[model samples]
Target chain A: MMDLVYTPDQEAFRAEVRAWLAAHVPKVPLASFDTAEGFAAHREWERTLASGNWGMVTWPESYGGRGCDLIQWLIFEEEYYRAGAPARVNQNGVFLLGPTLMEYGSEAQKARFLPAMASGEEIWAQGWSEPNAGSDMAAIRCQAIRDGDDYVINGQKIWSTRAVYADWVFGLFRTDPASERHHGLSKILVPLSAQGVTVRPIPQLNGLPGFAEIFFDDVRVSVDNRLGDEGAGWQIAMATAGFERGLMLRSPARFQQASRRLVSLYRQHHGDLMDPAVEDDVLRCYMDAEAYALSTYQTASRLLQGGSIGPEASCNKIFWSELDLRIHDTAMRILGARAEVEPSGSSDQEDLGTWLDGFLFAQSGPIYAGTNEIQRNIIAERVLGMPRR
Target chain B: MNFTYSAEQIEFRDVLHALLQAEVGAERIRARWDTASGRDAALEAQLRDFGLYSLMFPESLDGLGLSVIDCALLAEVCGRAALPEPAVETMMVASPLLVDVLDRGLGNGSVQAVIEGVMSGDARVAVSHAINPHVNFVEDAHWVIAGVADAIYLLPRDKVEVTPLKSVDPSRRIAKIDFDPEEQYRLAEGEAAAAVLRSTLNRGALSVAAQLVGLSEVLVEQSVRYASDREQFGRAIGVNQAIKHHLADVAVQIEYARPVIARAAYTLSVSPERADIAVSHAKLAAARVGLLAARHGIQVHGAMGYTWECNVHIWSKRIWALVREWGDEGFHKNRLQQWLLQSNALLGPEFTFGRRSLLPDSRVSDPVSADTAA
Candidate 1:
């Protein structure tokens, strides 16, 4: 029977997750991961979650996960966000690369990377966008020449999230010098502390070095680090991008929590913010959040029935990114003049800084994980079968 | 929680689609647009034969005894074809109201006769809820289920004065129905009437929302087909980025609107307490997206979209007509606002479908009564 109600076992699983999260989630929010201390704190939080086998619940039991299905993963996320747990610092590994590795990684690669990744011992950063290849990712000029027993890579990867403190980074590099566009690239895993590697922190709009630029000066790694075939980087990166844009990353629970906060804010200030227009905007944010959640549940249900995620990932990406921005924008609007003034006291500073930080971060959503424009083109050409220019 | 439709639901939709494809077409809708009655009796009989009218009625009453979700699926297909019938108002709204009236022993012989006549395809019912300003398709209806304040009345078409009103959609025959309280047959009054009226409006909104979703799909499909075939500047217009992006935006809107409608239908059937939020969410999204699809469909069709010959206008007009049918955006927004501001209801991802009990500081004592409040 096709049912929306959770099964008995799934309900029990949700109860277990809720109980664990309630007891363990930090009372005070952790600092931004841009600083070394804050990054280490997030890493410690990830390790604590892993100790309870809650690091990556969807991975197989052998990989330190419970081997739960997507539905259970969604339930876990709902509980996690509801409990106000610290953000997943190892998201790049657990959300983006972890699923791709499961799909395309060789047995040796899986055995070597999955356990450490599940345990948050080896945090990962994405190395996709470069100074020249932000939207046109296939135009990457980074090259990794084949050596006797290793591939010597020489490239500069910019906008690499968590590269300043992450242990390893996975990215696409040109393998076949003679090929062009999307054909000659290869996905390779490289350690940030490898010889000939230098990382420079780049401050974001919020004055945080949450992302960095990685320069590879003739870095050499064994052929075992290459995933799949030598010149199949585009396809592999796309699979990873699908996971990043699809169900795993940006779970609906995150926005739901934001919407709930927005509602709470509205309720607290209803006497002052009594305009029907403001009320309508607040309701819209709540509606869009609920709509996105329902849509994602439908997608999760479909995927659990052995269905594959298609260009709908582009659709999901566009919907949620815009939704996040709209919700934050409404929050700022609700704050009104208070939005303009910086907090004067310690408690007020922390309380007000959360919304300010959120507003700044939401701006990056459309730019990262493939720009919304690029996503629209993909939807137009690939999903809708429109003629490509 | 599962969100996909069951195999049976999919099969039911497929059957209705096949029937609509075979019987209802643009040409049929266009033909009916010029007629005085603005209805295709044969098509209505065919749909009735398919058990669409009996979908939400009790099985003991010789009906199919299906839920609102099943009725919503059929209504969507009807909207897709622009079937020019009151399937949504009759099957989804009026039939269930009739059943509730009968179940409560509030129905009289007149109401029973009308229900039998509607179930047997011999009569049609037009509902006039307090929320809707005018009664729709009353000229073609034999019975009018009119709501006045806290009571409901079963008024025969002859007993009421229906002042014909022109609608943007030519196929829709709407009117302001005025009946004397003494002359009409009272079906239910007081709290029971209020409950029935609320249920009627929610189902009405859900049906219209589903129809708007279907119409949105039709607009997108029609525009895509036109763009693919109509060439300009030495190539198909769809190849251009401007046209492609416009259609793509419409597609995205339709993509999100669909699940909202489905979820609303589910909430109506399973969680009546949360029906206001779910239905308003569905109606708001569907109306917004449906209007977007209509505007883009016309823009993509260029000058032809405004003409009577182009099939896009038929569905486009229906979109405009249905946007304000059950409840306008402002009305539903107010309903949601009350829930958010007054009820202190839990608002989060886990509570999307009304898991209020799960909240840590949940105010269980003051459960949201927005449905009744609205």
Candidate 2:
């Protein structure tokens, strides 16, 4: 009744995943998928992976996946990170929207989007937060007016990751002219190639166009693009958000890989560094990552028993985001002055410069996928059943 | 792989929780605080009759043949209720050692009497591990189980000279025991003794971890209840973002720790060889959350938590005591580091559940995946 042993099939699957990744994972790490060249390179890698049917292992085989369970997906991720495989440029499509579509989209929509999503033929940018709708997502005011067979969308989406090189965007828009807040909104899938769509790249702290501002000027997308029914966008978006904030987007193995690297970073410096605090920090990172991994497995186990991820997703979001911050923060502290040194050409620079890049990027962990403050409030009100203001 | 409790495990836990709820409330726990022994005879007897002490013994001895996994949640229940008993050692720690010794044909005459007495609700046994010098509830114990250097003994309580100590937790009757790990009382020696001692220490840590997790829940629950009822800034403090956030953080820690503790119990039951590492993880996580629960629990209570009259202090103080006992922070942290520092330490998400297989090594060839020798 209580067991933690992975089945022989699962072990074989992990071995197969490891072996394939070892053989096919790029010898030279692909560039950050934010730039155009990097984007195309990552897309090529995804195509290579898709050729091996390694695109989104949890999805059905018809959609270019192995139709694996969550455990297998976790194993796939473990090997993926271990292999230092290129980041999936189509994360927004495969990780976030793909699951949402499977849950809420029509059969036609699934057939239309999933294979391309998994194959990285169409990279997606999430249109979640706006200038006014950052933490308060219910403050969404973007309009998508219904006209005959098309919904002409207008207004802007800010902080859209990958929108700079993305081919499509999935967003929430106000359908009813009189509608306010989260009500009367619909989730619409739109192509960046649409006539009136404008993608303006936003340079991040590291001076990269990792983000973008998407402006839709009366862009007409077919009614068939709307996921679920009109006015049901909030519920559908929340489910997508549950996937975003929970296991799918930021898997535990990602942090574990980071933590392992952090530990390696410490071991290299453990001799010269007299700071026991660094050792403590490294230990905390390792243990916290393990705890997070164990927690995900527990959630997956429960989910396998037909349980849904509830408000506990907020807790997971907060845990991993903050953990990501701690890991990079510790690496920076361990590196000290040399942390900022971009020793790019040298092999020594790989670990050093990678830590610096990760440190810069880790700042966004607490901000994106819903802020930690907002997550804490959700945990309080929903999970703890506390009184809300 | 299933990570769930059986119907038997759940039912036994529920019944024990029900009985503890009915018999050993905060008031009952408070009642024992005034006495140095911290024993409620009526409640202890009821607990024994309800299959608490005899839970881990063999079925042939008129006891439930339950392992640590089945009995683990009961430790948590006892913790949640702040049950002032040495039930942890009697059940999770000493019981297994007693069974092991019995299997070696060592429980003869007096040892056999002690075993039968403990099972049949007539006697209580407290244990003293080498890692923890202070024995809790020694005055109330009929026999003392002591593990030292290379031998373990089941000595009569009267044989050990006990020195009373100033207790931190009001419900704990703390003492340092001077037990002779002599021949007549010795249960097992040499490798047999070391093996039992190692596992028993892990069991102690795991049981305490379960209790700490449960203790943390009480602190959060009490604070949440108080925050909702208490008004501040013209509304219930529970509505304040500050209060909610504090409790929420504690709740998050609890959510993570609960599964780790359960996993530790599973490890102890299924793979005792790996229990040290697993149990240390459980211990470290529980201790962290337990301490966090106290810090936030007190802050959320304001002046009330600082007061002795408040029940929050009762649970908080118990958390403080439990955290320092059963392989403290440094002990467990060092244990984990030692295991993790090994070159062959199979880490990553895949090895989290499964043991090291005979599968030929791959992936460790990756620089980051390669383990550094410590």
Candidate 3:
């Protein structure tokens, strides 16, 4: 039974997920459009999953999920990658806020928001990463004043993913000006339809409106919309960030997909007879992917047996992020001349434009989700027990 | 799953560290390097009494049943002190296979006698081969384990001739042992002994790699301290971008290589099948880092580094010799390429493709919680 560590039941689950994905995944041709209609199509794909009750596979059934273990979720992700499902458009809500709400939301808040959230009826966006508070999130200047029954929020959140399309913005605002850093912070869920709120989409390198800059001017949110206590925002936001950094957001299935695409591209273009340096880099990418996959599997297995994540998760995050960059760089090297220009329109080629796009996207990996340098500092000081410099 | 050291391994490391601190400090190491025999017999006996000698062989064959990882921890301490002892050469090389043969009565009692002799501080053994240029003081060995044909050329001193050559490192000497075909108790000729010997050689390289890591670590620490304290003009030399960046680069190299060495050692101890690829990668990474670290250690020391008074030369020379031994960077890289070609046959094309596709988007999201974070 323990030959390859998977059981017949797990295999059966994989088949079931594969079959479901085959039947439901949309076959509409995509042209890499930047219009609202294209994004709407992506959102509709997410809604399809929600309608089928396949959204948030690991969340509680009450929140419109299957309430499955990590293994089943992993299987579902594998199938999702295999079936080439359109990437999730509401990642901020489905991956981050949805999990945070499940953990820390009030009974009233859960009953009010979770159903719509799970059904993709409302889209959510993160309000972290201010202009000056990229890696140092605690230095955010966004402030909130406690009124009689509501908190008036006034600040700007830059690099807010999908904020232009999102119906809700979950953010951290300083509730106590007298208190020091990270103290007196409160997490508030504000409806984007409120007065004095505007979201302008930020142009990314791939010419996609991948993120936005949100301006909140005296936006009033009911105190009941707070995810946790006023001062507990830092901790609750940390939970969301952890999910952002961990398996919930960055699954092994994604890496598996990337590795597969790279190998195909290498074979197609380089045909295994590329420059020795390129071959070495490709080999290194494979090794790093395998190591990361094995390490993550161990982490997931521990979580399945009810073990808490440790500082080593930072190590895992840094490794995969750096590795992701290396693999995409190798793909660019393979693509050679064509890797420079952006793809005009989506050709049927497997990885020509995709690799270039991914290469561009990988540039931000080390900066977002906490910089690689910070992660290294965490690994050195926290995991390896080295003294902080 | 079991990441932390076992209680016994922890205790073993603590005792070994204490012993190394007391008996193999810089002054003692320098004295041993100057001595005719490059070893301290009394201290060697003390280590044997602490069960360090029994670590490599199996418990059934009079060993301590310790893994290569345990031996690696000891190697780190020994390397830091530049201790001139055959701890690694003896344990990693001779103890496992040679002792196994001696215990099984397949080899001469002379092999077993040398083992008992080392345990009692009465005799020493060192290996030499033209194929590998890292052998130290092979002529001085009472017994030499040389590779001739498919079997170990176990030559006694009476049957072989030795011609000593001056080595750059003071802690070790080199000599070619001309093995005479007329004398030897046994030769186990088969793939079994060859496989075991190959594994032993890889483990030996990995042990040295661990030692090199320790040596590089000390070099970085010493260089940083010197940079901080050694002032020139109005500021410390460390304030200079050249000096500071040099030390920082050494540090980064150490970080890149040390984990590979540790992982290789772990593979040798637990999974023999993966040891080939693991050791190749470990050797390639370590050789590059060890050379850079050792050379930079001297460069950071300036004029004083060129002198015999400083112990940096001893560690640097050892790093060079050990890295070049077994398989150097180029040799290991080629080996890795070969291994990859072979392994490609077993893995499906989809496996590699899947890895590439999945790896780029791979993210291990940090779970939210102080308990999880810390």
Candidate 4:
């Protein structure tokens, strides 16, 4: 167990990433973009990361990737956020799409797509959740009928994050509509640049087009674009979701940092008018964050030691997501009416506004990446040996 | 980072538990407490004959030479039995340092006598509060290993006047001691004396904390069992959220206290540099949580648990006594804050461990020093 202890080399690796991020992350007076400009700047930031060979960490070096260990990738992320690096524009690619491509994409497909994907030349967006298939992906009605050597896809995917600015779309399509619910699906990689594909942005309560709806009309893609075997789309999509559960999504240290920030903010705003109960709540948040960090570290150690991410990963996800919501909520409570006040000027205004943005975004944490309800159900049914209804 | 016990440690704990259960079972524990020495003489003799009493001493001193972790494991079983014995006073205090002090102060004659006495179970020594400056229980002891602000006071049982005091736990004796100031033995003095006493006292406190953790485990486990087995309104009381959640809270306390106690014991055994903070944390955490388990054990067991006929009161009183023994929660927390301020401010980031949210609903318990010390 103590073998999880880091050696000097790991510390040196952390230092190296810290120094690199501090030097390369732009200090430009860039606005917190909520529109197309934000997307452009975010894309530019991804390019900057690519230039530093820090993009697609843990991906093969042959595909413009570093081929670093997961620990190294985590270290890079830690420093990236510590240095206040710009938002990762290709979150869909790096988190959801890239790993799937590496796992199920053919050699020709990898050779064709991995480099551009890593270099931030082409951004990918998820086209999985549709109007009727939000939580029920197998209920998807999107059809991809095979014609000659090409598959003609015609369907509408909704709540597709970043599809409005995406260069390509990757998702599951029911290639055999008459087949069984899950057996009918096939994972397809479709180019959003196709003349028949149309994208429309959906404005969220946060006033950002963080999501979009994409309509496919006779879009054509070669059979080679299908990941894995036919009717294996459910397996491929599950693998992507599994990756999202593990290394691709939030890091526990990230939550730890946020919890610390909440503590510091609480300290900053201490006054007689403030409710003293907030103090205990803030401390509770810190404890939750710490426990979650320890749990995640244990998970990372297990993975490093060649262990599979088991049902415990679900526990870690449920823990950290709930912790994230609590910490952000605490920050909102601490900010009080200022959270409601729009920023007129100054960085303090921007910082408070950004926290408010995070507060708004954090509401979806339990709903996304396998809802906490689903997670608890898994824990009760699979891990805790409860009888399933 | 390794939080597991070695196989030897596990075997040792198992054997010790069996020995304790057979010798000083709960049935005999109360009667032993009513005795003069507050322990079972036959059990003590057997443990001594088995080399258990010599754990903290070196081989050169005719001891088993075990680590503090070994002592902690043994103490835990003693805690579970609520067995009032001088094993802690001797192993934690007298054997480790007093023997050497005796050797130095009164030459080899006194040293040899005390060592043989401890080994043979004939000579029972206790720490007196004369040294503590606030409390004294030396009169209740055959030999009072006492210390003062500037001197070591070896107040023999014959010298100090003793008066029995009302105690929260009748199983252990507590007394007010009046000592002759000029009769100080002065075994070790000044900074060296202070350092030795602090180290010894801290080790004792750590041992007590570990034992309290063990006792809390018993209380919580038994309460949980009772809750599961006892039915109320056609279902086990455990089904009631109030009862299960209380038991769960006690479970949380045990979980949180275990690591702090382990860390404190480990620090005392391996690296003394970190002992102060580790012991304070351990004492504070254990005492606070132990008190909760004690109180909740009663509530969980209801009216039957509050009576002397039930063993719940036995565990509760023992927990209460031990909580206020060395340094209660308030004193230890103050000490921790003091140490935090006075110590070299290194990279000590204040990250709360275990479950901090549970603190709001739990009451912190005080530490109980045996009659010997304040």
Cα-based lDDT at residue A366, candidate 3: 76
- The global Cα lDDT (0 to 1) of model 4 is 0.68
**Taking the tens digit of each residue's C-alpha lDDT, what string does model 4 give over B28-63?**
877765666565557777888767777777777777
DockQ of all predictions against the true structure, Cα-based:
0.62, 0.63, 0.09, 0.10
The chain B TM-scores of all candidates, as shown, are 0.94, 0.93, 0.84, 0.85
Candidate 2 segments whose C-alpha is farther than 4 A from its true place: A243-245, B104-108, B358-374
So what's the TM-score on candidate 2? 0.96
Question: What's the CA error at residue A121 for candidate 3, in Å?
Answer: 5.3
Candidate 1 global TM-score: 0.96
Per-residue alpha-carbon lDDT of model 2 for A1-389, expressed as tens digits? 77777778877888898889988998988778887888899999999999999998988999889889888887888878878888888888888899999999999999999999988899899998888999999899889999999999999999999999988999899999798898999999999999999999999977889999999899999999999999989999887777544888888889888988877766667677555787777778887888888888877877887877755677888888889999999988988888888637578678788888888989999889888898898888887888885
Instruction: Estimate the lDDT of model 2.
Output: 0.83
Better of 1 and 3 by DockQ: 1
In order of appearance, the predictions have TM-scores of: 0.96, 0.96, 0.79, 0.66
Model 3: what TM-score for its first chain? 0.94
lDDT of each prediction vs. the true structure?
0.84, 0.83, 0.68, 0.68
Q: Give the per-residue lDDT digits (tens) of candidate 3, residues B106-180.
A: 666577677676555466667653347546766566777765445665667667677776777777777655756
- What TM-scores result for chain A when each predicted structure is judged separately against the true chain A? 0.97, 0.98, 0.94, 0.95
Which tens-of-lDDT digit does each residue in A141-160 have in candidate 1? Answer: 88999998799999899999
Name the lDDT value of residue A98 in candidate 2.
Answer: 90
Clashes of 2: 0
Q: Tens-digit lDDT track for model 4 on A78-182?
A: 666656677777878877778888888889989988888888888888888888887666798999999999899998999887787878888889999798667
